[model samples]
Target: MYLLSKALIFPPVTEADDDGLLAIGGDLSVERLILAYNSGIFPWFNQGEPIIWYSPSQRMVLFPNELKISKSMRQIIRKGTFSITFNRHFKEVISNCKQMYRPGQGGTWITDEMEQAYIELHKKGIAKSVEVWQNNSLVGGLYGIDLGHVFCGESMFSKVSNASKMAFIYLVQKLEKENYKLIDCQVYNNHLASLGAKEISRDSFINYLNKV
Candidate 1:
C-alpha cells in the first residue's frame, strides 16, 4: 500500500494513489490543514501513525436545507427535552467521541496531539462544537471547524440511540439561522446517509468549498 507524500495534495480532484493509502507523513500545519480541506481532502490515521490525507472520488456532504428529520424525530423536537449549546464543554464532547467504540470499527483515532491542536483552533474561533444535554448530563455532541461559510464536521458521539441525531438536527437549524452554507460530513456512512447526507463529485464539492 502507498501513502501520501509530505502532506502535499495532488490535483484538486485527483487523489494520490489509493493503495488503500495516500500520504505517508506530514505536519498538520494550519496552512496545509486548511488547504487540504479546501481541496476535498482530510487527515485521518491511527494514533502513532503518520498523518494521512484522503480525497475519494465521491464526497459526502449535507446542505442545511436538505436535511431530513423523520416524523418520530420531529415529535422528539416538539418536546424540547434535549438542550443544545454551542462551544460549551468541547473537551467533554471530544473525550466522549474518543471513548465510544462502534461495532466492528477500530478504536479511537483522535489522539492527544490532535485534541490539543483542535483545542487551539477552537480557542482561536476556527473550530466550534454543538453539545446535547439531557437531565443535566452531556450525552451527545459534535465538533468541527468553521472556514468562512463551510462547516467541516470532524466527529460526533452519542450515548443514547438518538441523542446525536438531536444534536445534528439542532446544529443544522443553527447553521441555517446563521446562513452557513454546507456541512462537510467527510465520508459517507449508513449513519450519515440516514440523516440525508448525499454524495457529490469531489470537483463539485471543491467548487462550492472555494466559494466559501
Candidate 2:
C-alpha cells in the first residue's frame, strides 16, 4: 500500500490491495477528504492507527429506486413514530455515532480527528446528517458525505429499536425525491443488505461517481 505524505494525493484505486486498502498515513484535511470521496476512496481506520484509505473491488451501494422497507418499518413510518430532519445537529449526530456500541465491535473508527474533519466538511456544505427524533428526543441519526448525486454514508446510530432504520428509510426517500442516484455504504453487511443495498463492482461504482 502507498504511504501518504504532505502531498494531498492518493494512489490509483486499481492499485489497492485485494481487501481494498490503498494507502495509509494521510491527514484528514478537507481538501483530501473531498478529493478522496470524489475519486471513490475513503478513510476507515481504527483509533490509534494511521489513516487508512480503501476502495474495494466490490462496493456496497443502494440505488434510490432499489430501497426496501419491510412491512413493519412501513407501519412504523405510516404511524409517524419518528420525526426526521436533515442537516440539523450534525455534531450531535456524529458524536452519537462515535459512541454507540456495535454488537460485535469493541471500539469505534470515528476517531476525534475524523469527527472534527467531517464536522468541518459539514460546515462547508459537503457533509450532511439525518436526525431521527422520537418525543422530540434525538434517538437516532446518521451522517455522510454528499457528493451531489452520490452520498457516501459514513456511520449511523440508534438509541431506540428501529430508530436508525427509520432514519435510513427517510433519508433514502428524501434522496429519491432529489433524484440522487446512489448511497455509498462502503462495505457489505447483512444489516444494509436487508435495506436493499447490493454489491457492485468497484469499477461500476466509479463509473457512476464519474457521471455525478
Candidate 3:
C-alpha cells in the first residue's frame, strides 16, 4: 500500500489494488479531498483507523436520463407529502447520516475530521446536500461533492420510509434538468441499483471525471 506524505498529491487511480485501495494515511484537507473526488477517488475508513483511499475497478453510477422512478415513488412525489431543498441544513443532514443505522454495520464512517472537512468543502461551494422535509421538520436527506457535470454521492439517511428516496429522486430530476452527465455512486449497492445505478469500468468513470 502506498503511504501518503504531507504533499498534496495522489498516485494515479490505475495504481489501486484489486480491492481498489490506492493509498493510506492522508489528511482529509479541503484541497486533498477536492483533488481526490476530481480524480475519481474517495476516502472510506472507520474512526481511529488511518484514512483509506479507494478507486474501484468497477464504478457505480447513474446517468440522469436513466433514473428510474417507480409508479409508487411517482405517487409519493405527486402527493407532495415531502419537500426538497438544496444546500439547506447540510450539517444536520450529514449529522443524521452519521448517526443512521445500517443493518450489520457497527458504526459510521463519517468521523469528526471527515465531517469538518466536508463542511469546509460546503463552505467553498463544492459539497452539496439535499434535504427532505415534512411539515417543516427534516425527515431525510443526502449529501455529496458536486463537480459541475458529475455528482459524487457520499451518504444519505432517512428518518421515515421513502424519505431518503424522495431526496435522491428530487436530486436526479434537478440534475437532469441541468443536463448533468451522471451521479457517481462509488460502488454497487442494491438500493442504488433499484434507482438504475449500474457499474462501469473505472477507466470509463475516470473519463467522466476528466471532463469536470
Residue 203, candidate 3: Cα error in Å is 0.3
Which candidate number maximizes lDDT?
Answer: 2
Residue-wise C-alpha lDDT for candidate 1, range 110-199, written one tens digit per residue: 887778777777777887899998999998999988887888899999988788999888888889888888899977898889888998
Off by over 4 Å in 3: none
Global local distance difference test of model 3: 0.94
Residue pairs clashing, model 2: none
What lDDT score goes with residue 27 in model 1?
69
Question: Which pairs clash in model 1?
Answer: 3-22, 3-23, 4-22, 4-23, 4-24
TM-score of 2: 0.99
Every candidate's CA RMSD: 2.3, 0.7, 0.7
Residue 177, candidate 3: alpha-carbon lDDT:
99
Computed on alpha carbons, the lDDT of every model, listed in order, comes to: 0.79, 0.95, 0.94
Stretches off by above 4 angstroms in model 1 are: 1-13, 18-21
Model 2: per-residue Cα lDDT at residue 61: 99
